[model samples]
Target: MSELAGREVRFRNTDIALMLVAVLPALGVGGYGHLMLGIEILDKGEPDFSLFGVAKTLSAIVAALGIVLVGAQLRGRNATSIPPLVLRSLSGSMLFLLATALAVILVPRSLNHFVRELQPLSVLTEVVLVGALVFLVLSVSSAWRTGLGTLMGINGSVIHALLSGAVFLILMEETSWGQHWIGFGTPEAFKGNLQNETNLHNFYTYRFELVYYSTAVLAFVLLPAFWPKRLPQMLSQLGYYVPPTWFALFALPVCGLMYESWNIIPYQIWFFCGLLTAVVIGRNDTKLRMAALIQAALLMLSQLVFLTLGHNMEDGYELSEVREFFISVLIAGYALITWRRATGEGASASST
Candidate 1:
C-alpha cells in the first residue's frame, strides 16, 4: 500500500510536468495571436514591425521547443503508458484550445487576414509535409544502415527513389527553399495567382496535392494492400520497420484537402483508407489497430463538426478554424504516443 501510494504520487507529478511542458507552446501561440490582434484592432491594417518581430520570435521558440520535446520523447524510455499518455495529450490539447480562446477574446477578428491567406493552417500543413520528408529520409537511412537496402530489389529501390524525390520536391515548393523569407521576386507570369508575395500555392492550385495524394496512395495504400506478395514486399518490410503510427501521417494531407475544398470525399477516402490500413497491418497488435480506428473515427467527427457547425461559429472569432486546429493537434498528439509505443516495441523485437 505504501509503494502504491508512492507510485501514484510520482505519476501525478509526471502528469503535471508534462502538462506544463505542453502549455509552453500554447502560451507562445496565444501571446503571438494576442499581439497580432492588438495590431489589427489599433493600427487598422498596417503591420507593426515591433509586434510582428516579437510574435515571430515567439513562434520560433515554440517550434524549437516542440522539436526538442518530441526528440527527447523519441529517444527516452520515460514515457507513461498509453492511457495516461492519451489523457495527458488530450488535456494539453484542451489547454491549447483555451489559449486560442483567450486570443480570440483579445481580438475578435484576429483570424480575418489569417483566414484570407489561410495562414497557420498552411504553415501547419507545410510542417507536416516536412516531417514526412524527414521520416522518409530517416527510413531510407535506416534501411541502408541495417543493410536492408540490398534486400529491397529493383522495384523497391525504384519506389524508394521515387518517394524521396517526391518528398523533396514537395518540401522545397512548400518552403520555396527560403525564397519566401529572402523576399525573392515572383515571376511576371505567376503574379496573378499568388496567395501573397511569398506563396505560390494560390497560383499553382493543387499541383502538389495531386502529387502527394497519388504518391501516398501508391506507396502506403496500393502497393501494400494489393502488391503485398510481389513488388511491395520490400515496402511492406519497410513499413514494419517503422512505427505503425506512421501510416496515419498521410491523414494530415488528406485533412488539409478537406479543409481547403470543404468536400466530404476526401474525408471518406481518409476514413476508408485508415480503416483498411489498420485492418491490414494491425492483425497482430490490438493496441495499434485500435489506435488507427480511433484516429479515423475522430478525424471523421472533426470533419462533421466543421461542416455542420463551422459556418455558424464564424461570426467573429473564426471558431471553425480554432476547432479544426485543436482537432488536428489532438490527432497528431495521439499519433505521436502510438508511434512511440509501436517503435518501442519494434526496437525490443529487433534486439531480440
Candidate 2:
C-alpha cells in the first residue's frame, strides 16, 4: 500500500509539472511576440527584433517541454483521460486562435500580407496558433486510452514541437541573429533543412509545416505505443529485411508527393519500427497485431493522402502517387490476412 501511495504521488507530480511545462513557455513567449507586434502597431509600425527574439526563445522552451512530456508518457502503458484530453485540445486551439487574432490586429494592413515576409512576432504567432490547433485536433481524434498518454501521444504534441522549432529557425533569419543562433549554414539550419525539390523560399516558414508536423505527431509518436503484437509477429515470420523494404517502397514516393521536406531518415526509421512492432505482436496474438497495424497505417497514411492532394498540383501529378497508397494497402492488408489465417476460424472474416 505504501508503494502504491508513492506511485500515485509520483504520477500526480509529473502530470502537474508536465502540464504546466507544456503551456507556460507558449504563454510567456507568445505574450512577448504579442508585444513585438504591438510595437509595430504603435510606432511608424515596423517589426520589433528584441520582442520577437524574446518570444521565439520562450516559445521553443515551452515546446521542448511538450516534447519531453510526450516522450516520457510514451514509455509507459496506454493511459489517457477525458479532462486532460479536452484540456490539451483547448490549449492547442486557444493558442492558435490568439495568435491569429494578434496577427490581424497588430501587423500592418499594408505590408503585402506575405506570410513569408511577416516579422518574427508574426512567425511565432503562426507557430503557436497553428501548433495548438494541430495538437487539439490530433488529440481529439486519437484512440489513446490514458489521459496522460493521450495528451503526450506522438501525434499528440511532439510533432508540434518539431514544427515550432522549424518556424523559429526561419523567423530568426529575418533578424541578423539568424546566423549567430542557427549557425547560419549548419545542416540543421533552416536553409539546408528545408531546401527540398521545390526550393520553396520559406520551406521552413510555410504554414504547411504546421500542418505536416501536426500530422506527424500523430504518426511517429502515437502509433508505436499502441501497436498490436500481431504486427510484429507477421514480420518476424517473414523475416526482418522484407518489411523494411516494403515500408521503404511505400514511404518514399509518398514523401515525394507530400512535398513537405520531412526528414526522410526519421520517417524511414519509424516505419521499420512500426513493422517490427507488427511482427512481435503477430507472434503471439495475430489478431491484436493486425488490428493495431491497420489502425496505425490508416491514421498515418490517411493524413498523408490529405496532404498530398492539397499540396500537389493537378496539372502533371503522376499516377505513381497511387503506388505508395497501394503499398500501404498491401503491407497492412497482408497483416490482416495472416492474422486471420493463423487464427483458423477467423481467417475469412478478418480478410474481409
Candidate 3:
C-alpha cells in the first residue's frame, strides 16, 4: 500500500489526475487512438524510450530512491527528518520553474517572430511547468508521514499521476521542452499545434491547448490538497466491492461506443460505469483486500490479453500500452491487499 497509492490523497496527486482526466476523452476516442497509432507505425515514431526519457527513465530512478528512502524511514532510518527530503525536492522544483520562466521570457524573443508565429511552443511550455510545479509542492508536503505511512504511498501515486500525465501531454505536444513560445495567447497557437500533429517526423501531445489551461488550474488548486489522501481512500473504498478487475474496463468507453454506433454513448457509459462501479464495490476491510486482488489480477489479465491479442494484430490496433512495466505494480497491489485483508486494521471501522 505504501508503494502504491498512499493511505490518503497528498500533494501533486491532484495535478496529475486533473491533467490525465482532461486528455482521457481524446485518448479514448477510437478516432484519436487510430490517428495516433497510425502516426507511430507509419511515421516510425517513438515514445521517449530513452534511458533518460524524463517520463519513463528518470521517473524510475526517482521512484527507486523515494521507495528506498521510504523503506529506510519505516525500518527506523528516521535519523534525518522527512521534512528535509520534502523541502529539498520542493526547492529544486522552484529553481527549475524560475529558470523556465526566465527562459520563456528572454529566449523566445531572440528568435525570428516567424518562428514564434508558427510554433505551438508556448502551450507546450505550460505542460512542463505545470507538471514541475505539481511535483514541487507534492515532494515537500507536510503530511508525508501521517496516516499510518499512507501519506508516503499517496505521495507515490501523486508522483505517478504527475509523471504519467506529463508523459501523455509531451506525447501530444511536438516540442520536447514545452517552453514558452511566440504568441503566448492567440489562435495561431492552436492552428500551429493542429498542423504539427500531421508531421509525424515530430510528435505533438495535446490537441486543444486551451483545454490544457483549464486542467492546469484545476490540478494546481484542488489536487495538492487531497491527492495524498483522497485517491487512495476512494480506490480503497472502490475495492470494497468492485475488485480491481479493471481490465474489464479497457474497451470500456471505446468498445462501448463502437457497439452502440453512437460516438458519445460509449464514453458516457464508460464514465458512469467506471465511476458507479468504483463506488458500489467497497463495503469494509475484507472486501478491500478481495478488490485489490481482483484489481491486480485484472491488470495482469489485461496485459496478458493485450499481448496475446496484440501479437496477432497489426501494429496500432493493440489496446493502449500505458505500462511497459506493470508486472511489479501487479504484484505489489495484490500483496498489499492480501496483507490488509489478513490483518484487521484501517479506515477506523472493523471489517471482520
- Over 1-352, each residue of candidate 2 has an lDDT whose tens digit, in order, gives 1122223112346666776776676556545545754421112111122555445434544554454444344222221222343234323323432333333334423222333223443444434444433433343323132222112224323332343454344334333234433444443343453532222344544344344433443343333332221323223222211222112212222222222222122232233334333333333333244433443444345334433332332321122222222232333322332222323322223211
Q: Against the unseen true structure, what C-alpha lDDT does each candidate score?
A: 0.40, 0.33, 0.29
The lDDT of model 2 is: 0.33
Q: What is the per-residue lDDT of model 3 for residues 90-118, given as tens digits with 9 covering 90 to 100? A: 33323432332233334423322312322
Candidate 1 backbone collisions, by pair: none
Poorly placed runs, candidate 1 (over 4 Å): 1-145, 151-164, 192-204, 210-246, 249-267, 272-285, 289-293, 312-352
For each candidate in turn, give its C-alpha RMSD to the true structure in angstroms: 18.1, 20.9, 20.1
Q: What lDDT does candidate 2 reach at residue 294? A: 47
The clash numbers for all candidates, in the given order, read 0, 31, 29
Residue 244 in model 2: shift from native, Å?
13
